[model samples]
Each structure stands twice: as C-alpha cells, then as structure tokens.
Target: MAHLDTLDDEVPDISPYVTPISPTNRFYRIDTALTVPQVDPESWRLRITGLVDNPYELTYQDIRSMRLADYVITLSCVSNQVGGRLVGNAIWTGVPLYELLQRAGVQRGAQQIVGRSVDDFTAGFPTTLAYDGRNAILAIGMNNEPLPTRHGFPARIVVAGLYGYVSAVKWLEEIRLTTWDGFDGYWVPRGWSKQGPMKTQSRIDLPSHGSRVNSGETIPLAGIAWAPTRGIERVEVRIGNEDWTPCRLGQAAGNESWVQWHRDWTPSGGGRQQIQVRATDGSGHTQSGRTVPPRPNGAEGWHTISVDVR
Candidate 1:
C-alpha cells in the first residue's frame, strides 16, 4: 500500500460556486487508509463470491470489453458541514454494477453486497439498491481520464443517491454477497448512518463573504445544489430578512448530477448584509432551516454567508 492523505476538503476555489463540472484534479477525497493501495490493471482481478449461483472473476481486460457508460454524478462526503467544500461533480465511465451482479445471479438469501478494496477497506449497501433503479457502477475512469491513484486507480464504486462512506469503495478487489443480518460498514461502527442516503444540500459560491460590493449595483448571487436521485427543482435565496427569491437554474445533464443556480441581487443599503440559500428537491421536499452538524450521517440547514456592501 502507498501512503495516503487522510482527509482533503479542497474544493474549487476559482468561482467554485458556479462551476458545474468540477475538474478531476480539484475533487475532494476522504479515506481512513493510512496508505493507498496500488493495483496494476494487468494483474487486477475482480472476484464475485458468496451467495451466488455463478461465482466468477473478471480481469481488467474483461471489464474493458463490457459495454461502458458515462455517469455524470456528484458525490459528497458525509462529514461535510452545511456549506462545506467537500462536494464535487464529475463524469465517471464504467459498467453498471447491476449487469455484473445479474450475470453472477444473486442467491435468494443474499441481503447485502460488500465491496472489499485492495487495502482491506470494505463498504457495502443493501442488495435491493443495486437493482432498484439506482445507478451503481464500478468506475474505471474519472472526468474522461483514467482513475487517479489517490482516487481508486484501477476502479472504484459510485452509487447514485448514497453517501460515500457506505458505497464508494476504492481500489476494489472483491465483491461478496452476504446474508448476515447485522452487517455494518467501516463508518457505521464508528458512528454513522447504516443506509447512508445523501441529503439535499446547497452552497453559496460567488461574492466572498466580507468583500465589499458597491450598493445599487446588481450583484450576482450563485452556487450549486445537489439531491442525487431526486434532482433539485428550485433554488431560493434570501437576503437578510427579505422573502425568498427564486434563482434561475442552469441546464442539468440528469437527475444524478448537481445543477448551478444564480440570481442578481442589488444591495438596498450600504453596510453588512447576509445571504442564505435553500433548495427544493424534485420529490417536493425542501431543505429545512434547522441547523445540524454532520455526524452520524449528513448535515442539514441552509447555507448562509454574510457580505459587506459599500
């Protein structure tokens, strides 16, 4: 195993709030591994075992020969606080995990599918999710480039609508189906939600807080919103105690990808002012105003930032 970075919260710094597609180099990563595993594609083997009628292994070439699809998706770390910089969007290329599982033929008793990494790290989710219309895949490419060593080189796991802790297994070596009723991921025992569904969240990107913008001039307020399986329907911005105003959303590739939103705001009076943002998902659920920390699962509440107007 090679050395690894424990946690990286580095988000896009240049107009980060407006950039819809995050560059592969600027994406965030979180891991508990003390060292990253280096797996050679030529020597790699993906084994499917346990509770299956046709247990088999697939070589790297085997994976490449299968039909490949592009998944433009956004993923966020569970530890990210409200308005935190641990979220990113990228186009991942891989084969749908469902295809592999179907070929292996899951047994009747299988309840969960566990993905074990070369570094010995493991995380899995309910088997139902694999066939439940969610796009879970074994990602071999990130942003049109080969997967980075730090970001699961040969391949990794990406499941729509789920948090990274329970689904994003990197440097994958084996996928095993389990009938254990009490199976838990690495983070579950360490205090996290077992299911790990992602929560709807938004962030403010433009007009750095504390920077002064001239009053009477229209200032553009913008950011990004993500809801995974359920797309963001609308984004609303609040100025100080003013009523919520709708923001124009940019074109989105799909429901699984994050969308950009922006609205022009003209400061009424000079001095300090506050801006807050909230989002309503395609399922008609709006983000709550109640503030909560990102523990056990994900964070909650609107993203608020204060700015100075001259």
Candidate 2:
C-alpha cells in the first residue's frame, strides 16, 4: 500500500503576472516523456474492471446507447501559471460517470478509481468524487462538435470540482477501481497534488496591454472567473490600489464553466493603470490575497494587468 503522506508538502505562493491578451498564442511545449497514442473509435473499448463485481468492457456503440447530457465546463491545466492561457471553456456532451458506475456496482474496499487515457497518461481520483452526481461525464463531444484530437478526441473523463490533472482525463480508455495503494498518476509522480478543486480567481481582459485607449473615457473592462460546481458568487474589480467594487457578471454559460464579468471604468488622467480582479465562490470562499504557484494544486489569488491610456 502506498501512503498518501509521502506526497510532497511544498506549496509555492502564486506568482502574479500581467495577464497577456494572447495567453494561448504560445506553443505548449509537450514533455517528450509523455506518449500520445493515436485513437480509432472502431477499435476502442472502455474497460471497467478491478474491484467491481461485474467487470464490463464497453464498446463505442454501447457508450453511444447511454443518454447524453450537455453542459459547459472550464478546464485549467495545473501547469498554467496565474493568469496563464492553459485554460479554456467549452460545452461538453456525454453520459454521466455516476450512472455508469451505478450500473457496474462498485465493490467494497475500492477507495480510488484509476483512469487511463489512450495517451498512456493516468490519474487516480477518489471513488467518492468519481460517483458524485455533478456533471462527471464520459464525454465524447465538446462545443457541440466531436472532441478534437488535441482535446481528448474519442472519449474523455470530465469531473467537476477538481483540476484538469485528475478531472479531465483525455483520450480515456480504462477505469480500474483500486485501493489507493501503490497508485500514482503521471503528474503525481512529478510532484502534483492527487486531489484538486479549482480556487476562486478572476482575470482582466479588456484594454489589452500595449493597446491605446482614449484618456478619461469610460471603457468596459471584461474577463471571466470560475469555481467549478460551486458557481462564481461575485467578482470585484480594483484600479491602482482603489477600493474593490462589484462587477456585473453575465449569465453563466454553465455550472462548470467560467462566468463572464464586465465593469465600466473611466481612466483618471492615466499614463498607465493597473487593473485587478478577484472573485468569491458560492460557498463564500474568497480569492486569496496571497499568491501561489500553479502546481500540486490549482493556482491562487487575483489576476491583474496594466494598460496605457494615451
């Protein structure tokens, strides 16, 4: 049995960076050690076994037979630094994981369910989370389109309330119930936390850096924030050490995705002004004033950026 206590105790404070306009423009350098396998749905089968009384192997047709539900979700990579672009919002469609697990009848002593992806990457999540009723899906589609090759393709696992490392298992193939003993996922071995629930955080989007804006004119500042499953309760904006003020949050795209916010601000004789954003979740959890790195767990603190008004 592998002890969870052996995991590293290091949690670096979040490093705040000016939120870039083109956060996803940079190439996400892939680690050469991680292997990605090509997927063919015709040859694909999802095997559910180990610690289940009725071991089942499901074909594509079988999965398609299950009822499909749709919802929007925000996925953030643990490697994404504070204000980084490794996050995206998409509408996903698929069968609920708990429904399938109920059909399989989990056996006693199964503490964790190890999900293996076609890419050969693996992550283990606690069984309690896997069976939670809130939007945990064996997703086959995204944004009303087939899952893209780079984004899970044939099938993936989407679990609410956790970081992408464990909740978003791309190119999923097999799920095995385990005892939480001698189990470590791809990122876990690399010093990430086994459990991840996204933190409450917000970003600044309008009046991009290096862009010219009219001085003393009211401009709409916009961005998005999320606290999955638990919706973003409130968003606040601050300009240059000013008091935080509430911003208007648009209709949420979905329960698991980012909520858009907008606030109108007039530049006060500014050469350059720093705008900051923070959010509170439905649980009343507020964004941390203290920053932290995005590792082991999700990133922390508010996102900020500076823009010039000419």
Give the number of the best model, judged by lDDT.
1
Q: lDDT per prediction? A: 0.85, 0.72
TM-scores of all predicted structures: 0.94, 0.86
**Clashing residue pairs, backbone N/CA/C < 3 A, model 1:** none
Tell how far residue 303 is off in model 1, in angstroms: 0.4
Stretches of candidate 1 above 4 Å error? 1-14, 180-182
Query: Whole-model lDDT, candidate 1?
Result: 0.85
**Compared with the true structure, what per-residue lDDT tens digits does model 1 show for residues 230-261?**
99999999999999999988777688988888
Superposed on all Cα atoms, model 1 deviates from the true structure by an RMSD in Å of 5.6
